[model samples]
Target: MERPSLKSWAEAAPRLVAVAAGRDTADLVIRQGIWVNVQSRELLPGHDIAIAEGRIAYVGPDASHCIGDKTKVIEAEGRYMLPGLCDGHMHVESGMLTPAEFARAVIPHGTTSMFTDPHEIANVLGLEGVRLMHDEALLQPVNIFTQMPSCAPSAPGLETTGFEITPEDVSQAMQWPGIIGLGEMMNFPGVIGADPKMLAEIAATQNAGKTVGGHYASPDLGPAFHAYAAGGPADDHEGTQEADAIARVRQGMRAMLRLGSAWYDVESQITAVTEKGLDPRNFIICTDDCHSGTLVNEGHMNRAYRHAVACGCDPLVALQMMTINTAAHFGLERELGSIAPGRRADIILSSDFHALSVETVIARGQVVAENGTITVDCPHLDWPDHARSTVHLGKTLGAADFEIPAPAGANGVRVRVIGVVENQAPTRALSADLPVVEGLIEAEGAVCQIALVERHRATGAVTNAFVEGFGYEGRMAMASTVAHDSHHMIVVGTSRADMALAANRLGEVGGGVVFFADGVEQALVELPIAGLMSDDKAETVAAKAEALGAAMEAAGCKLNNAYMQHSLLALVVIPELRISDKGLVDVTKFETTELVEKVLQ
Candidate 1:
């Protein structure tokens, strides 16, 4: 299908204005509402909205003159009429659903626009993956713009991916329809060092007059951070502190605070606006990564709004962060971000601003959702066979495959461990001394074994390492195919037998999450689509995910959102320690580390 051209929308403006002025009739009229004008930050009561040809023709005191006998009328009944919410940065694949299903899940929550980066898929399928996500996004009723993925391997030499994206790929994608801008450049070090590939991608985005998204995961706000900002990323969502937020805005970059399924970054960062009294216009709210469970059980943008309100942010200011600020950041202010004349007629009606309970949703002059239920069609794409058959475990494995050998004749050994920080993406690089038994090193107290099983190729290779902070107490193990970026298999367990069972179970069911105890499979969430997402509805996936969480708790692992930590074990971009198919990685130094030291007792 051909994309609707901006020229067509421009040419229809005169006829649209005539309909607004009562000289002509409109297709739809929304009557008697309190308009929450975001531009002026005022609420005007007893206002009516007139729509013609899927564009807002008039927004004023009365639209009765423009309402013809054939025009459909929607009675707002004194509700607050506001612009539909926009997610400034997110990953649609993170929802564990296709773009169509993701839109269906969020529409009732009053989210009409999203800026998505499909880099997760790009890591697996390259440009074909990006085009698939982009094409499906344009087919939705609401606006789902795609930001051409900037980094595929995310970090070039840090880890290997099923496919590698080149600078040529980035430049070509910028010209595609629905291409908003470059995706988040996760290669902060590369940008700071002026790596040719990273710089070229940024230059292409700038030359195309589009936004360059940023992701600086380090806590350092020093010279490296400054250099990354100078490398040309327009916005960043990796800020986890008030200072991080303040610094970004002070440097003329939009600070995006995210509240995803497991990432609780908004509370810590919103203080930049609520208490520090910084200009709220430079801030935006987003859900960087929300799984199917969160989208189905909790709301999407509505959840972010409520969280902002809970953080002591004013209701209007919170709305602005999710709506106007986001639209303006992507250069879509005039086209969207408000319920005013000439903007796309994407609006939401709610009884209260504080609670943000969306009673109805209007998009492109049509009612799409009402009272927590989607009332319109969101078409799904037919995923090809190649997408489904992606999980490749090189060989079948047994318990012996997971054994970690200690240095010869060593009584004790010092081991580097990856520490899982609760509700945050960054992990702690910790080292611990442990006793060795029979030349085999075992995870003794809070530490457990973490293995990255190569699944992309039938390599059946397991790179073993140690991880802390999960608080696991017994002979249990957990396995998941949701490893970030590469989406490989990650298994963490105290017992080798249980670990083997959990790993093989995922291979059996194609891909998803599994938990095992005492060599018995306890729980599983079957995500058959691309081994990354589930074809089941979000509610169904949520129920299975809830069961998986309960199984984790039952197995003696206690940590807030430990499943999120499990999913990121293979994400080599974040600092400290991570396991890839090659070996254990010291991400802080960006070098491969040896599993065992050459020493003897």
Candidate 2:
């Protein structure tokens, strides 16, 4: 699909002025709406908005002068006319859908803008992959900006990625049309230590006058955190506490509260503004990672804002966080974030502020969706053959590949177990004692075997560990190629045979999440693009994801959005424990540790 040639605001200013002065007619006009003024933080009833050439030409008490015979007028029915909501930070691959599908899914929910980091694909396909996502995003009718992935193997030396994002890559991407800023700098320790490479990447983005995204995934807000903030990250979304939010804003950095499919962080952090008297301007709401089910069923930016309102944030303040605040953070405030003159004519009409049931969605002067149905075509890229085939296990994995051999001459073993925390990114580093059967230590109760299978280089190496929390009962297995940061294949299950089957199935299908119980395949969501996203429609992928969740519950897992938890198990950057292609990682210590703690006789 050919991308639309971008028209500069200067080129359209003369016509916008003419329309506002009543010398020219607007292409579209919306009348009789209660304007939700994000900029002034007030509600103005009986307002009209006029658009010309996909940019707002006039906004005030009346746009009657700008209306002509050809003008498309929409009666808002006293609905709140809001600036289109924006997702300040997210990953399109997290939805398991490509750019086109993601836009299609969210447009109906009033998400007119998206700022996405394509690092998931960058880990598998590198610069070419980033370009693919960037180009496709530019073709969307709504705003979909790309952030050049700054970290591939997010924790360097902890794991290896297919390709690394260097200062040169960052510099080159800054020149891309859709590239908004550098993706989240997940190497917090490196930035704090002033690692030359990490600093160089941040410098390139700063030099280009672009925002440097942040990921300080630690609870330690000490001198280390201060040093990291000084190293040049513009915003952070890893905050899980009120103190974290206040700390970031105090340091002149935006505090991004994220509410993804699995991570519920708004209620804990929103109190910084709701309970405390902190200014809300510097606070942003984002969805760091959301799957297709969440997008299709719950909502997008609407979901985030509604969740914030539920957590006691003012309804108007929440809209500001999702709209102008995000736009200003990305240096796009004058272009797309608000419903003012010269800004993109992206607006939503809703009857209720609390529920935000999107009745009509407009983007760039076009009614894109009405009553929860998309009216425009979201173009797709013709993905090359290489992009579709990425999974490569050196050979067929078998039951033996997953076995964690017990320490020699031991009746039982004390081992390091990863404890997963529901509705959060951080895991717990735990110690557990389990009896050995034959030559292997068997995982019991809530514990399950986890193995990271090398897929990028097909080394046929598996790093085995134990994780407790999924509560699997039967001989069940789950495997996914959507493992965070590393993009490797993570297989977890009680039965080694089923684990082998699950891992091989993803390999055969190229990439996706698969579930198996009692040696039978139960559900699968095929993500054939770099093993991260599906090129199919969003609804199709959402249905598969929904089924995958049901199958997970049927296998005795009680965690909400367990697929997200399974996919993030390989995120070595976040504390306290994670699995990587190399070995078990103690994230708090930022190093690998021995799997077995002690030998029991």
Candidate 3:
């Protein structure tokens, strides 16, 4: 399908003037709605909106004079005419669905705009993959802007990607129509250290006059954070605390508090606005990584808005965070993100501010979704064979591949474990001592085996380590190619045999997520697109994901959205400890370290 084109303000200005002056009929008109002017932060009741050429032409107390017999008008019935919600920063592949499918799932939730980072696919298929995502995103009826992935490996030396993204790639992607800006710059160390290549990538984006996304994962509000702020990143979404949010906004960076499937950073950081009385304009709300279940069962940006209201934030402030604030952060204030004249006619009809029951969603002057159902078709791209065939594990594996060898004649070993914190991106660098049996350290109780398999190059290398916090019982293992930063295979299991089986099964079917327990395959979600995203419908993938959740619960693992937690084990950028293709990464230190702390004789 050709990219959906809407007239720019320059092209529609003549008609807009005619329509507003009551000399011409609007393409669409909405009557008697509470106009939510996000720019002025005011909710004016009883107004009409006139749209022409897919752009808002008039919004006032009445647009009756602008209506013709050909015009399509809807009675808002005193609903709040909110500017459509815009997600400032998100990964479309995180939902395990392609861009088209992801849009199909979120349109009903009043999400009319998205700024997606397709770095997950870039890790697997390079620039071509990013182009593929960019192309499909433009085809959607709703706005889905693609940020040129700035980090493929995410952390340059910490891990290796299937394909590395270069400065040339960044410069070239900047010219693409859908390429809004560079994706999150996860290499904070490189930025502060003034790594030339990292600086060059930022330079390319800056030279192109686009927003440079940020990802400062550290909690240090010291000079390091200040240096990173000065390094040209315009916004950051890795903030987890009130201080982190406060520090970022004070430094002229938009503090994006995200509420994803497993991340609950919004509530903690929202207090900066609610309590300290900081300006809400510099604070944004986004979903950094929302899975399909969250989009389908709960909501999208609307979910984040509701979560903020529940966090004691004023409803209008929350709406601003979800709408105008996000658009302004991306430098798209004049184009979209509001119901004002000269903007894209993307608006939502909601009856209540507190409950925000989205009754209708309009995108580009078209009714895209209504009453929890999509009314428009989100176009799909024909994915090539190379895109689907990404999983390339070198050889078959066995239980030996996951074994951590004990030190010479040691009875017990102190291991640096990747501690899983429930519902947060950062992990704790905890240590645990376990007994060794026959020259191998075995997983005991809460401590399970975590292995990073080299699926990118088919190098047949497996880095073994231990992780705690997921209290799993019996023989079970889960394998996923949706590992963050690097699209490698991460398997966590009690039984090594089950881990091996799950990994092999995913490798057999291209790529996806799978669960195994008691020597039987329990659940699987096939993501054939770059092993990171599925071409199937969002509902289909969500259903499969639900079964996988059931399997996780059956194995006695009871962390909220444990699958999301499982996928981030290989995310080396977020501190404090994470497993990678090279070795155990101490993110706080920004170097590879030993898995074992010491050996007990």
lDDT of 1 by residue, 254-332 (tens): 9999999878999999999889999999999999999877888888999999999998998889999988899999888
TM-score of each: 0.97, 0.99, 0.99
For candidate 1, what is the total of clashing residue pairs? Answer: 4
Deviation in Å, model 1, residue 435 alpha carbon:
2.7
lDDT of each: 0.87, 0.93, 0.93
Question: How many pairs collide in each candidate, listed in order?
Answer: 4, 0, 0
Q: Comparing 1 and 2 by lDDT, which wins?
A: 2
Which ten contiguous residues of candidate 1 have the minimum total lDDT? 1-10
Candidate 2 clashes: the total is: 0
Q: Which prediction has more favorable TM-score, 1 or 3?
A: 3
Error of 2 at 291 (Å): 0.2
Q: Candidate 1: where are CA atoms >4 Å away?
A: 1-8, 595-601
Q: Write the per-residue lDDT of candidate 3 for residues 51-75, one digit (tens) a residue.
A: 9999999999999999999999999
- CA lDDT, candidate 2, residue 523: 98
